[model samples]
Target chain A: MNAFRAVAVAMLLLGMQGGGVPAVAAPANAVDKPVRIDIRNFAFAPATLTVPAGTRVVWTNRDDEPHLITSAGKQFDASRALDTGDTYAVTFAKPGTYAYYCSIHPMMVGTIIVQ
Target chain B: MRDANDSTNERRRHFLGCMAWAGAGTLWLMKGGVLQAQPLGGADAASAADASFSFVQISDSHIGFHKEPNPDVAATLRASLNMINAQSTRPDFLLHTGDLTHLSRPEEFDTLGQLMSEARSGKVFYVPGEHDVIGDNGAEFFRRFGERQQAGGWYSFDHRGVHLVGLINVLNLQAGGLGSLGAEQLAWLKNDLAGRSADTPLVVFAHMPLWPLYPPWGWGTDDSAEAMSYLRRFGSVSVLNGHIHQIQQKVEGNITFYTARSTAYPQPAPGQAPAPGPLKEVPPGSLHRYLGIRDVRHVQGRQALAVTEEVLS
Candidate 1:
């Protein structure tokens, strides 16, 4: 009887551990942060921004003319003209400061500070 | 000595030629002026006013447009400016009703700034069009022209006994392409006009049509009626807007709504095209004739605006 009770307690512990596994694992994969950048009138919204590493930043064009989101040193080029309501996103896997501007309108400059 | 008579004969011939040319010129002048008279409406009234305080209304000067309808917008603007400068009564100032630049690029803005500075009228008042605030993060326009303006480029001032109100409706343009006036600005406008009596002549200038010019093109403001409600108490109200690139006028009660032509290109009339864009190429020189400026004059407590569309042929 003693041995059987001990086995039953072990089974209860396994069930609790199984339930906690999902809870712990769920948090690791559940959080997603997306940053939005707006393009209008030849300028960028939040001309300056800060985001955590691995955050996805989306750019949407709201102006009539075509625009581009290209990194300052030509590291990444979203060369296509993003139409109105169209979005372009880039995930910052590595932490760094990225300065960008619309290639079509160079005067439209913005900075994304990633930490 | 024998050729003296020949020289006299030559001089006589020259005299006769001049006489003939003068006769032809007189006939040509009669025909030309007669043709112009047919379309010259309100000429008698205009001529009666010996002293007129007239100002120029330039709307939708969408610079940076490289389309066929208005292949050379800057040139057309220059032509319009020249025409305005050459008018018999030089306008006191210029009122630009928005969409100053096509995409609001700094270069485009810079270019527009340079061109406007060159205008004969040193004073130019502006409001924002939906296009002007794209990606500006809400302050690009103010940084350039908001030194004296209130609330993101909306302001009021008195000019020649006329109360001019410039409103900002293009910020955060709605999804349906409607212009919105935030609660703060609307309240400010209401308070701004609260003290004024009914006799005060008010002129409201915005980028989008304050009335329903056309909804499909997103030409009209969404909350324009609310804005108009504030103006109903005024005896004389004139609301002018751009963004449609055509001339349309409506009179509701004591209020008059006028949409000015774009100095850049012509868009199709409402319901005339599938979508709003640069119209097809009209023959060269047709655009300037179609697009120009409006001249507004206030006389004897009456406000009359004469639109002179000059095609740059």
Candidate 2:
């Protein structure tokens, strides 16, 4: 898997250089299986996510501060305030885009797309 | 060997004694309806004695927090209460701006309550920090420390002739936004201040800073500008806030905005760190210098209140 990823990234870089594309790098996190979202340093890692419709997405709080998972559009039931090392999981069955944020620290936001 | 150990112990005690009295607390003199600031210690007794009443402000106790910079937050909070109890000028009340607990746990609130009960002040006012309202939207906080049965956890009252307002801005917060005082609370504030005279001195306390000190980190409030509009008519307005975990002051016209330091831990200065949270890099034994409390003095006839900030060290 590592070798495949390295080759794929190299080929993509070469393609970008040859095609004179913008200096954008490939997506760092592309998960096809169950995914874990880390809440750290007052942020959600992989802030923008894309996953399969049946994938179950899990969010774990890593910072000492607590975070409450709230959907901006009410797409999902809100999670209880997650303390350090606590987690909340939700399965994305519908293929759509959803937005969510930490209700406690509203400044922290994330987005997920299920396809 | 014994003599060497004794000398070291004596030096350590001397160092701690010096730390306790190291920082200077401010003495706010209310004269002719305006407040002026001076050093607190050794101020003329005649002036301080003439003050009508005094109150204390302690914030961000974060009782459940057990981490670097300070492990035992309860101990520090107890120390803070001790200082207030030992005040030469007994404070009439105590205001805990917010962040009374680290994660809003039941035991955390219980510990805070037990510790604050020892304060010599007559009353302790409270507002909810983001940390205090977790999980239940402040149901536990309201049940424990709320002053009124109001829905928004915001209320006001008269203390020593000064109009004090405790506003809750940590609820219904939106994504990618700063702290918010929703429309309901804003309307309440309008009606609350409607009958007050412009000459009445106003002291507003909230969990987040009312002024936009640093918006990127959510240190300020979103609709605080609107709140300031209602307060503009007042002759003297003092807004106290916690959550930044450090002391910062900004004065605009008649309104003065003050953010108090946390009794639990300190955070980096605005833009000083990559993010805003507990600062974990403090050197040993210096954490107390960044943690402390504020004392405010009010004279009966004056329209302003004097504020004093003292570090725990």
Candidate 3:
């Protein structure tokens, strides 16, 4: 755990430099563990999720068809079209309820609550 | 073949086309914007030998798809083209209603284009399915297949006295809604049909059904009622769509609606299954029975057009 903290600090310092760095990368911490949401049968598994702010959420497409992620209220950037086995990730840095749906199949909807 | 016998042949063809799915091969004849189903291989089939003009409609090719009930979509699409090529009278043009690719991949579209070009059929026209516009808002799709870029892939043309309109209703979709035509396309459609003679026959082709067939399954369009209002002026309006991946028909007053079967795998009927996706539980060697093409014949001075369906098998 101490080594993990050290690496996290190092990444923070590098990210602080700003140029050519992924500054928004999730910090290394237990609370920040990435969450996963699966897309299958044209619906999102765990249609609702609640997590702490700054938690990274990963969406993986497992259905035979393609899906596109779009924020219902334009809360965050929309994802590109995800084909079978393709995955997309978004990090929530603020506390708010985010509702989204598959633009390709708009009837498929899900909600994410970041507290 | 002359105009003298056209009305007599039209009446006979309508009788044969109204047998109501009498056999496995169902034939549809659309008259005055209404459709009647009949059985194929009937003795009266030769009555339509001299249709004024004929075209073929194929939908949901889904070229990149590799799934059960059909693991080889390319083979099925090739089979579809083969069927079209073998028609006794070659089609004057082909209308692909949409979902031409499984995942909107470049190679998927490439495969479809190559195979379609090789067919002896006439010029091919296309409308964007939801799948075709997945990424970059259909930039790739329009670049390759769009005839009118400024019009946003929707265009109208006159063919042998019939006005055919290809519409794009799969873009700018709203969340938690069904297929949409947006305000822009709706305005364009209203103007596209303005001041035209009501006597002109109209054929409107889109990716999804214009009427609200089933809202739960996203099988209908939201603003389609507005679009339909524009079509009500015409005496004969035949609306053709292909997204449900199966054949379905409905008629509203002056408009007749028909959905074509996909060249790819089959999809469950509305609310038949838990949700709408691929149907993988078909018995062995029965997939071809669910895939087919639609043949439409327009006879001049006749209010309705004749539609014949041919399965891949």
Candidate 4:
């Protein structure tokens, strides 16, 4: 839990700097795209993720059921029912901790830390 | 938690009525004090045709849902249409309780419309489910089906001397579970039924169950009791709902409450699973057993509507 708080703090600091350090020192051959979060078996593959600001996270519903990505504070971000093979992408322009869940199934929660 | 819920739902399923899964179906006809399971095609066919009018009910078609126990939901919906088309005496119209589409996508609605175009019934009535209004405040759903209705998208009509009300209870979800029909709709409902005679049979359809079928799973509507208060005087009343993705019926006083099965996929019986979502792990070929629609037949002189559960056999 403390580690999560530390990450949240770091992301907060980075967000203040405006689009924190590049998510990764991209290799010249790497393609620039959003990080993928797969919704399968009613849960996000990586329950929690840390990425740099200006990084886009694309959530793909690979399960047969529909899953949504809604931030804790609905005003932050929310997606349509992400049906099978449907994808929702949002760029984390501001650094902070965004806790989201599939509003349909509140148990399926995930966290994304923007650094 | 799941195990505990499974046991509770198991007991509740037995206590309420026989468990009618997707396959081992049971359609109980209640008369007086006798509750008996009758075949889908029983001797009541002729009687059902003589004095009664029938309307096919298909709910939670969930048109864009492609996953597990049943991946191709369109096939099940097509099967429902086929059943409706093949009805011995054609039903008057179709009533889609709610959850027409999984994600409320335009293409999803397009697919639903494309499939519905082939249905035998020309008229299909719909109310928005939480899934249908996941993101927008039912703007898209209202754009498609909420026509000439009040601002909140609720209206009532009459068919065969029975007053049928389509109520919207999914607009404002409270605390993440259970639907709420604001006071405005309830007032409209009360006013709508004010002038009607007490003998008028009332049928109310919504996406969420009006009665508190199960609060833990968000299966019931919060302010539906107010809506029910208006219809309490009616001699015969039936409430049709979807979203639980299974059929659970209750007969109280003069009213009968029924939740419909989904044409897309089945959810765990109330509290059977950790939460109410699609049920996976069921064998593929047998999915049709759990996915089907309800057929309601109202004999003109009778006080009850003979409800039947016909699966995709």
Best by TM-score: 2
TM-score of 1: 0.62
Please give the ranking of all candidate structures by TM-score, highest first, separated by commas: 2, 3, 4, 1
The segments of candidate 2 whose C-alpha lies over 4 angstroms from its true place after superposition are A1-32, B1-47, B289-313
In model 1, the runs with Cα more than 4 Å from the true position are A1-115, B1-52, B289-313
Per-residue alpha-carbon lDDT of candidate 2 for residues A1-115, written as tens digits (9 for 90 to 100)? 4334655887787786797654455445333346889998788998998876766899999987778889999999999878789999999989999999998789999999888
Q: What shift in Å separates residue A111 of candidate 3 from its native position after superposition?
A: 1.8
lDDT of 1 by residue, B281-310 (tens): 455556654432222222222334323232
DockQ ranking of the models: 2, 3, 4, 1
- Per candidate, native contacts kept equal 0.00, 0.80, 0.82, 0.24
Q: Is candidate 1 or candidate 4 better by DockQ?
A: 4
Interface RMSD of each: 10.4, 1.2, 1.3, 3.7
Worst 10 residues of 2 chain B by lDDT: B18-27
lDDT of 3 by residue, B1-313 (tens): 3473674464345433422211112233434433343222221345335346556777788888887657888887777777666656566788889998877889988998998897786698899899898777888889889987456778889877778899988888887899999888889889989979988889899998898988898999999999999998787788889898766777665677888767776676676555677666555676565433223333322335434343322
lDDT of 4 by residue, A1-115 (tens): 3334455776777788887585533243221346789887667879888887777788998876677888876636688776678899988888898888776655467888987
Off by over 4 Å in 4: A1-64, A69-75, A83-115, B1-20, B23-44, B289-313
User: In terms of DockQ, which candidate is strongest?
Assistant: 2
Clashing pairs in 1: A40-B134, A40-B135, A41-B134, B285-B313, B288-B310, B288-B311, B288-B312, B289-B310, B289-B311
Which pairs clash inside model 4?
A: A64-B67, B22-B289, B22-B290
Output the worst ten-in-a-row residue range by lDDT, candidate 1 chain B: B20-29
Interface DockQ of each model: 0.02, 0.54, 0.51, 0.19
Show model 3 residue runs off by greater than 4 Å.
A1-28, B1-45, B289-313
